[model samples]
Target: MPDEPKRIVEAFSQELHAAYHKAGVRSYEAFAARSTKINRAMHSDTGKHTFVSRSAAYKTLTGKRERLPTWDQVAQFVRVFRAEAADRGIAPDSVGTMEQWKAKYEAASARFWAAKKAAASRIPAMAAAVPAAFSDGPQTWWRAYADVVPAWSERYLNHEPLSHRITSYEPVYVPGLLQTPEYAAAVIRLGHGDEPEERIARRVELRMLRQRHLERVGERPCMWAIINEGALRDGPVGGETMRAQIRHLRSLGRHVQVQVIPAGHPAHDATDGPITLLRFPSSQFQDLVFLEHADSALYPSSEEDLAHYLHAVQKLGLAALMPDPSRTLLRRLEAEI
Candidate 1:
């Protein structure tokens, strides 16, 4: 029973492997290279391509990956196999039509997610049965700082470690994940003016620790930050502190992508407030939209709410400067300070 999801994923992998052989693809490396070539050729004008990594191919073909292949991945696999069959004078349909493979992939994906959901359903009860202090799980990390952080932020912290991708839009101060320690300390001091210095220091420490996720070797989540120009220019943090913060943002490297929306850009959909969207690796969990306010935060899960926030973020991305230009703007901001 515990292995149901694994069995379902493996069955799909077996089908994929059978199709690979039927298409006469010689090896996983060859399949990856051919798929990349085909994708580039098909989308040459747009300069768009999905390069299948050799590791990805090996994982998929061997059923070692825990999650189902994304639709784009499935489509790429089908196209690559079809191309190989055509070159060998074999009917592509003899290997497997795209429609047929899509159907199988969808069926397997549904069953796999269902199995995962069932397994996850037991977790809450299991956790309830165990004493919190004795249990050492992912939640422990957040639990350590719960006393210092606001109650409204609990949900976001809980999901932070589980997220594979995190996209955030900030119109005021720099996003927390990208804030430098000095900037973070200043922000914390301003927000909790009456709090003891010890508490503020702890909060700053928490924010800094949260950033360690970006430093993780391989499991780091992809972070996309869209910042308004006003946030950089008009924050309480200033002087060398702000300069250091800007430099920090500019130096985040590949794991973090930063985009800046110039001032006086056309009014956009996200004017209401800042938002964060967290996406997990598995389909069993729904993506989360976190809307934060001065004294409270809301986690909206309805389909309509999700669609609204998703659309807003998409538009915000378009309105923001491209990454290269954004980095240039950061450099200019840093120098001006």
Candidate 2:
């Protein structure tokens, strides 16, 4: 029988493939040559040389084989890629050290097996794409997914340097980038009521910092946000707070193209859920979809998952009020508030 697809392995494989591409190691011959050089520098293993054939390297990237690549094989790829990145003066923390690469490899391996186990116990298709981590599901599953990912804030917001495009659908509230300080504070306070005031303040500060990406000097991220009308209407965060937030959204119209999904839009794609799709300029780094939950965020790796969310965004865009009309709606909402 053929092996089932594992999103964890596929995701890691893409990252590894991207590392090689960024290093300008295109052909299998060149990759193997670099591997040999790195192996010689690290050790004097005359008998056991680092050798990965063209077919094997291709299989690793394509995720065609049943077994995951060995750690030593992954290490060789990482070292060569890191050295190339250094030559170009690029220092990404994701692949900065051997230990980091190893940790990621191990985590991905563990997740693959876990998915397989879940498939065996439940249904075979459960292992198809690792089930969405933050989809509407049990809290235990969500927590388990969150525990596996770290520095999520960094992963979500630090795409500033990548020159990517961001399209977000916000059904409940205004996006962080267009939120006013007072509005942000009120929302945070309500959500994290038990947290200390100082901690909440720090959290708010970090969120504001992430918003800086929108104001970058050259080639800032192209942002398109579609907000639901309910978010504007159902607000008890004090009239002044909501009013200011609406005005802030209007001001952000200068940079971000904001749209309003008027209340009772018959074609509301967000009725199911919301998603943020990120597209990169480089072909090496695949498009990403970010699903934000109450306490955790999800990065879906499957192409099917990505397509579903991207299609939702397109439908929302079609149903949304025009940009000029969206600003007009915001102004009208502000006056009512």
Candidate 3:
């Protein structure tokens, strides 16, 4: 009878955890609330013990008396829970086994997480304990890339307003931020294929937003894109669009530098793939190298890795026209087109 109850308790615990995970509820309070609601579906709210109670808590995540999915059904629903919890600073390990609960009636983890949040809010004065940017120490091997971008942007955006440089080699088309509306729309339609109208709108809208990084007028990314003479002739988006794009690239030199790798050159290495390298004011770190494929993108921030990209850029730039001559070439293209 004891083992039967234990087997039943295990099923309930798994069900309770499953509901928490399925609801996309990462915090304890959210999990507890979801568990309680589902528990009530099978029986009245048994409160903390509702999950363990043999009479309550449905086998399904929704707390529905029927439609209780098997354990296999639960896996797919909770797929995002583990990663989602890690992001929100919750641990899967904290949710213990049910046998421990029978030994000592600890409060439901979901409820406990909620209670802590409420308690923290009550003492507003103490809530300012953590600084805007929390760092483990002066140095750490692992810093999230998401944190690096904002912090680096904030520090370098102004001080090195002149020094921040981006030398890009785009093989496919104009870089997203520099692209014209017509070209952007053309590219999106080709890529999305049968994507819904809303999806197409979002892709265009996101590109337009990226354009603002350059459109800020005063302090902006000094983007220097080098295209093969072939790029000048390729014209995937077609002539009228290419004319606008090439002319736009030419016009940008008035505000920011533009360079064209002369088309007549026999062959070159930079044309092999597109590589974007960005420099920062802080000498503590080397320049950042961003590599982009069709759908995926990566920013390499480490010094050794960045140095390799920088050397490649140096060698590549040697093969391209200087800023002034590059501008002159762009002007000539405008006149010819």
Number of the predicted model whose lDDT against the real structure is largest = 1
Write candidate 3's Cα lDDT for 147-230 as tens digits. Answer: 322332322222222235667776456777678877787777765768787666666765675556566666666676766554
Q: Residue 77 deviation, candidate 3, in Å? A: 45
Candidate 2 weakest ten by summed lDDT:
133-142
| Deviation in Å, model 2, residue 189 alpha carbon | 1.4
**Candidates by TM-score, descending order:** 1, 2, 3
C-alpha TM-score for every candidate: 0.58, 0.55, 0.48
In angstroms, give how far residue 153 of model 2 lies from its true place. Answer: 4.5
Error of 1 at 93 (Å): 81
Model 1: residues >4 Å from true position, as ranges? 1-139, 268-270
Per lDDT, what order, best first? 1, 2, 3
Question: Which runs in model 2 stand beyond 4 Å of their true positions?
Answer: 1-154, 160-163, 268-270
**lDDT at residue 328 of model 1 (Cα atoms):** 96
- Candidate 2 on 122-181: residue-level lDDT in tens? 422312432243222333312323432345433454443343578989866788777877
For model 1, how does the per-residue alpha-carbon lDDT over 1-337 read when each residue is reduced to its tens digit? 2599889978898888888899999887789779868865865554334434565677787887655666557788889999999989989998888899889977887787677667655534322432442222444576777778677576678667767899999866799989988899887776587989888888999998888877888888899999887677645565678889998998888889999987657532235368899887775567778877555555656566678888988899999999999999999988875
> Which pairs in model 1 have colliding backbones?
none
